[model samples]
Structure formats: C-alpha cells, structure tokens
Target: MISTYRAVVLTRNGGLDALELRELPLEAPGPGQVRLRVRATGVGFTDIIMRRGYHPDAPKLPFTPGYEVVGDVEAIGPGVTGFTPGQRVAALTVHGGYAESIIRDAGEFIPVPEGLDDAEVTALILNYVTAYQMIHRVARLRAGQSALVTGAGGGVGTALLQLLRVAGVQAYGVDSPPKAGLVRELGATFIDSRERPFDEAVRKRLPEGVDVAFDGIGGDSIARCTRAVRRGGRLISYGFTSAVGRHGGGDNVGGLSGLLALFVGTRLLGRRPSVYGITQLYQKDPSLLREDLSQLFTLLAERRIQPLIAHRLPLLAGRAGQELLERGGIRGKIILLRDVPKKT
Candidate 1:
C-alpha cells in the first residue's frame, strides 16, 4: 500500500465552519523538495485572514493553511543537497504544513538548532524574521534612537524588542496591563493603551515623539502612530489585526492616512515613514533569509531570546487554535502539532 497521512485542509472559506481535517495520500518528494514529518506549526492571524478571504494574495479555496513548520526530514528528492534523513529542520512552507508530512522546497528550509524546543523554533522563524527585516532593513534606526511599538507584548513586538536591545536602541511599548510586566522585562518602557490614549501615553515618556514608530494596529491608530514619529524618524507598518472585526470594518488601521502620511512625511523630515503591507523577505529577497535565520539561531544558542508558547493543539484542532488567536487576548504563539505514528 502507498503511504498516507492526515492533514488539516479547509474545504471552503468565508466562515470558520469550513475548516476540516482531511486525509490525503503521501507521495515521494519532487526535485529540490523534502518530506518533513511535521512536529509543530504556528497559528497566526494570516491563517484566519486567508480563511476569511481577506488576504488579497493568498491561495484559493480548499487548501492546507500553515506558513511555518518544524520537523525532521523524512525523505529527500533527487538534486537536493545538504539535508539528510532525520535532520531537524524548520520550513517557511508555502502550503501544506498543517499535516503529518509535508513536501517543501529545500531552499525554504533551515536547520533547527539543537537544544531548542520545537515550539520555540516554530515561533521564532516567522515572528523574528518580520521583526529583523522591519528593524534592520526598513527602519534602519541609529543607536540610542527610540521607537514606540504598539502591541509591544505580542510575538513580533517582543521579538523586535529583543533585536532592538541588541542594536543598542531604546523602545517604548504600548500594551494592556496584563502584558506590561512582560514588556518591561523585555527592556521596554510601557504605555498602557487600554488605560489611556496611545499618543497621550507615548508623549508622557517620549516628549518630542519617538525616533521610530512600529504599528500593527492600522485603522485610526495609524494616524496616531504617524503623529508619534519624530519629524525625521521612521514608521514601520506591518499588520492590520486591528481592522479584522473590531473597528467597524474600515481600513482604519494604517490605510489611506498611513500612505498619505508615509509620503508627505518623507518630504518634510528627509527620512519618511513607510508602511509594509507584508514582510517581503519571503518574496522579493529570499537570499537574505539564510543570514537572518543564522542570526536568530545565534540568539537562540546564546539564550538571548526566549520563546513564549501560548498553546499547542493537534492538527485537527487547528480551527480551535485559530479561534483562540481570533478571540485575541493571548500574548504568544499557538502551535499545531502532529501525532507520532503508532505501532501496529
């Protein structure tokens, strides 16, 4: 009999009920591809956005929904090199990661460093890469320059804090009180957005506005973040979790105002603010990935960055994990795990 495995594939989009666990036959890998025995997968808002047909560029209906996976190489196709059977690796999968086995391009895979837990590696890849690219590539802040990050205790925000500290930069984070301690512990000065207006709270500490402003909450908050950036400072716009369901459904989070300000600010300050619709590391520049991953691996090896795992669920329970992510109170990553095969 041919090999077979289970995967979490959505039968449809537009609603949460469409999420279904399905079975599919496993096959040998194509050239430059490897079959991964997926151990863990991270749950991000991108999954939910794609599920709801909100992500403009995502794949069409009835497909597996996961962007990253951690596993061991089960099989390697011809023309592939370096990776061998049972090698621990993490893949920035284009699709099919929420499964017991996945065949993915070798170029997208990275060696999972020894001694780090699977959950940590899974969380680190997506979040840290976005953080690194936005900070080092996009923001390009000078030493001692300060930044204000909204949602500062979330995955990308926390990772940015770690990277910022490494670059000798100071950060002010806006978050709820429950997450204040974690933000402070990450070496960020905290502003409570739930308790006070984001701009007002940020001004109390920053006074003349921060050197950079990193915003994930787009809508109206984008305007506030635009104003908070120093005249010659930068604003890295990355997410729109703020516009998902809560904000009257307008592109309120960093929409037109963000773009207009992004352009106008450049002329006024010489160094202008820019909003990144998506982190381009995966698309425009894949070569930069190896270096970025190596840096993150070094941080992991040195124990300079620690992962906070919010929850882990079975692949079949991916919908539940997405629901937990949508309900929106967690501070870390939710991972989907595959079961180890059982003896007959």
Candidate 2:
C-alpha cells in the first residue's frame, strides 16, 4: 500500500490560489471504513464556496476540498461486509475527496456498475443527489407539472432538468444565451437569464406560471422566483450564488434574510406561493441519502439519465477547474482524474 499520495489541499480560505497540490499521508481504513484508490473526483460550485469560507459546512483549513469521488476499493477495514478490495464504488465525501486515496465508512460508499465511466458516476454522487432530493423529496414534483430552474446550465441545473424530463415534468431553464442550446438539449425550454425580470420572462413562456421554481442564485432572485411560481406552487432555494462576494464577501446574510422575509410574506398574505431552503448536510436521515443515490445509480446503469461532464482535468489542475467554474458558462460537471497506482 502507498504511504503517501497527492491531494488538492486548501491551505486557507480564499480564491483559486488557496488550492494547492500537496503530498498527504495515507493510512489504512479503521473498523467500519474502507480505503479507495480514487480514479476521479468531482469539482463543484460548493467546493468553491467551501474554499472561499462561505459554506457553513466548510472544513477546517489545510484539508482537501472534493465533495465526491469514484474509485476502486483498495482495502477494507475489519468487520466490513458487502465489499472487498477491487470493487468499484462512489461516495459523497462532503470534503477530503481531492486525493489519490480516501478512507470512508463502508456505509458511505455505494457500489457503482462496472461499465460506467468513473467521471460520470462521480458527477452523480453530489450534484445528482442534491437535484434528486430537491425534486422528489423536498418538492415532491409530480408528472405533468411545470418547473422553472435558474442557472439551468450548471451542474445541479442540468441534473434537475434531466430528472425532470424523466419524471415527465415540463421544464423551463433560465441561463445566459450561450447555454441556450444546452438547456434545450437537456429537455428544457431555455430563457435567457440576462433578460431583466426573470419572472416576467418565465410568465411569457408559461401563462399560469410554473408549479415549482428551483433557485440557486439566491438574493432577489428568490423573490423573482416566488413571483414566477403559480399560487400553490413551491420555490426551493439551495444556494446563494448571487449573494456570494456581496455584503462584505461570502456571507449570505442578505440572501437568507430575503428568503425568510418572502416565506413570512407568503404565509401572512395567503399568496399560496411558498419558499423552502435546502442544505443536504443537515438531513437527519442517512437512509434517504443512500436511497436517492441508489436510485440515481440504477437510473445511470439503465441508461435512463446521462450526467453532463463539462471537462476532465488531471488531479493537479483542481485550481484551474475551480477558476473555470467560477468564471461561469460551463454546462456541466468538472472532473479531476488521478492515476491509479500499479499493484506491487
């Protein structure tokens, strides 16, 4: 077994510069854990937020910053079952995934089908799970209902569109013009987000407004989504991308306050439109996470859904990947690949 491996470490909270490639010590999995030789790790906007010290779940500095990983099990801890070395798997690390090897609780690792690409399954762990939970668990989105997604060209946005399509939900996606084709290709009607008054744009497309509006861009965007949602419709806010770097940087106080006020206003005014915030980290049920991931994996194995992977970079290029994601205009997930060590 290797004693050391390379990982993308976040030395401090800052921009892309904060991400550094470092050699980290490798250790065997303890009881109930398994060690994986990571093949691919997913880069996400959440990683950017964590690196910027904006996410409440951000780990202490001098730690790795990947949220998801796909790999082959190199070792299994004592008392572990249902897995053996050489089995392929994927996991949601929440952190500590940007490395050549990771030791995770066996319960956290989900077996991935043999034929699927590592990068593809890695994308499903965090992005797809978040989208799945929001669409099915939180919103309970039903067939034939219409849904609107802001930042529809992004990782979660695209995942939402794919799942919405499978669920037979008519979908509208708001993004910049460059992403129009991608949005349409993903089975969503594309509305240019650059257009002012996003709600009006949405209304122009759907006269009755949408049944559900998914907003990751927080701030006034939440209010706009509220307006775009029909009475009795729901608006789910999962991120504060719009509020980032505003109000003294990284703090989403303004956006949270806006969402809170909107929720209260809707309740008091009997508007019938409701707003809900989601943070997957706080979910109390581990079974839900596992179930959602299993469903996604089954869908993937059946070729029912395809995850859009924007780019694949070497493990060392994590910073560049983050910079690209931050610059925007990417249509899908960015994956980082690490070379597997040859068996000794």
Candidate 3:
C-alpha cells in the first residue's frame, strides 16, 4: 500500500496561486468506503469556482478541488461489497479527487468497464452525467425537437451536443469563433456567442424558437437565451460562468433574480417556458446518480459517444491546468494524470 501521496490542496480561496502541491499521508478507507489509486482526475470550471471561493458547496480551506476521478481500487473497507482490490472504477467526489489516492463511499464508486481510457471515464462522471440528466431527466428532450446550448464548446456543452445527436434532436450551439469547427464536428449548428444579440442569432435560425435552451453561462445570458425557447419549452440553467468575475465574491443573487424575473415574465405572457437551475450535488438520491452513470458507461462501451480530451497534464500541473481553464475557449475536458513518472 502507498504510504504517502502528492495532492493539490487549496490552501485558501484565491487564484491559481492558492493551489499547493504537498505530500500527505494516505488514510485507509473506513466502513462502507473504498480507497482508490487515482489514475486521472478531471479539471473543470467548478474546480476554479471553488478555488475562487465562489461555489456554495465548497468545503473549508485546504481541501482538494477535483470532482471526479478514474482509478483502480487499492483497498476495500469492511462492509463493502461488489468491489475488489485492483478493480478499475470511476467515482464522483465532491472534493479530495485531486490527490493520487482517495477514500470515498463505496456507493459513489462505479466499476469502470475494461479497455476504456481513464481520462474518458473521468470525463463521463461529472460533465457527461450532468448533460445527460439535464437533457433526459430535466428537460425531457424528445426526438426531432430542437434545443440551444450556450457555452457549447466546453465539456458539458459538447456532451449535450453528442447526446442530442444520438437522440435525433436538432442542436444549436453558442460558443466563441475559434470553437466553431469543433461545434460543427460535434453535430451542432454553431452560433458565435461573441456576436452581439445572441438570442436574435438563434431565433433567426429556428423562427419559432427551440424546444429547449440549456444555459451554463449565467447572468443576463440566461434572460437572453430564454427568448429562444418556444412556448411550453424548458430552459435549464446549470452554471454561472458569466458571474465568475463579477463583484461581491461569487454571490450570484442579482443574476439569479434576473433569471427568475424572465421566467415569471414569460409565464405571464402565457409562453409557459419553464426555467430550472441545476446543481447535482444537491441531489438527494445516490442511486439515481449511479443509474445515470451506468447508462453513460454503456454508451461509451458501445462506442456510441466519445469524450473530447483537450489537454492531459501531470497531476502536479494542477495550477497550470486551472490557469488554462480560466483563460477559456477550451474545446473539451482537461485531465490530470496521477501516476505519471516524476522528474529525476
């Protein structure tokens, strides 16, 4: 068993400088928990949000930031079943995934299929699952319908496009100019968000508006995108990427209020466009997350969908990875490899 491992700890809320790489003693899994020798961890905007002390669910300082990991089970605690040491698995951890090894509730760990890339599996846990749930569970998107995905070049945005393709739904993606080709390759009609009047750009194409609109870039963007949803359509707000640099240290009350007003106003106009804000961490049922992850794994095993890996950096490069994500315009998921050989 490994005695000590390197981990990226958030010493305090700030920028990339807050992330500290330190060697720490590893702990054994308690009952109903299992320890994993992490192979790779996903680098996401949520991590940055937490680092900036914006995420409401973020833990106290000196915590790890990764939300998902793919690794082999290194040890199993008492009362844990359905898994054995050396089994490959992927688990969603609210934190602690930035470490080379982590202990998580056994229920949170899903056994990964053999022959799948670790980075791909890591991508599926958070980004793909969120997209799948939003489209299938929340929006209930149907075949032949149309939907608009804002921030459509990022991890979850691309996932939405891929899943929408399999469902036979027409997808319209809003992203920057440089990501236009990637959006097209993922089977979505690209609309450059940098262009003014984004809502008009979308409505001009659909005319009657789309069946649904998924907005992760919150703030006024949500109100504007709501205009692209047809009557009886749904608008799902998953993240507040636009509120990142705003004053007041990540409190998004004003932006959320604007979104609420839009929803109310649309209903008063008899449009009945439903608006929803999603935070997967607040989900009450663990089984539902497990089930969703299982279905996504099946899709991956069948080669029905593929996750785009934008960059793969060593675990120690956590600071640099976060910097890259903060710069924006990334095409897909950035992953941190945990077991990479260290420099001599």
Clashes of each: 5, 0, 0
TM-score between candidate 3 and the true structure = 0.92
- How much does candidate 2 score in TM-score? 0.92
How do the predictions measure up, each by TM-score?
A: 0.91, 0.92, 0.92
Model 1 deviation from the true structure expressed as Cα RMSD, one decimal place: 3.3
Residue-level lDDT of model 1, residues 1-344, one tens digit each, is 54788888878766668788888998999998888888888888777777876766567678898878889899999999999899999877655677888888888788877888787788877888778878887888778889888888887888888888887889988888899998999899988887878877777777788888888876666667766776777777787765665312335444666555556644465546676643355677776766787888888889888877778677657878888887777787887777523448
Residue 153, candidate 1: alpha-carbon lDDT: 82
Ranking by lDDT: 3, 2, 1
**RMSD, every candidate, angstroms:** 3.3, 3.4, 2.7
Clashing pairs in 3: none
Q: Is candidate 1 or candidate 3 better by TM-score?
A: 3
Name the candidate, 1 or 2, with the larger TM-score value.
2
lDDT of each: 0.78, 0.82, 0.83
Which candidate should be chosen as best, given lDDT against the real structure? 3
Ranking by TM-score: 3, 2, 1
Candidate 3 structure quality by residue, lDDT tens digits, 208-268: 8988888887777767777888877777778777777522256477566656745675675
Candidate 1 ranges beyond 4 A from true positions: 246-271, 277-279, 339-344
Candidate 2: which stretches are off by over 4 Å? 245-248, 251-253, 268-283, 339-344
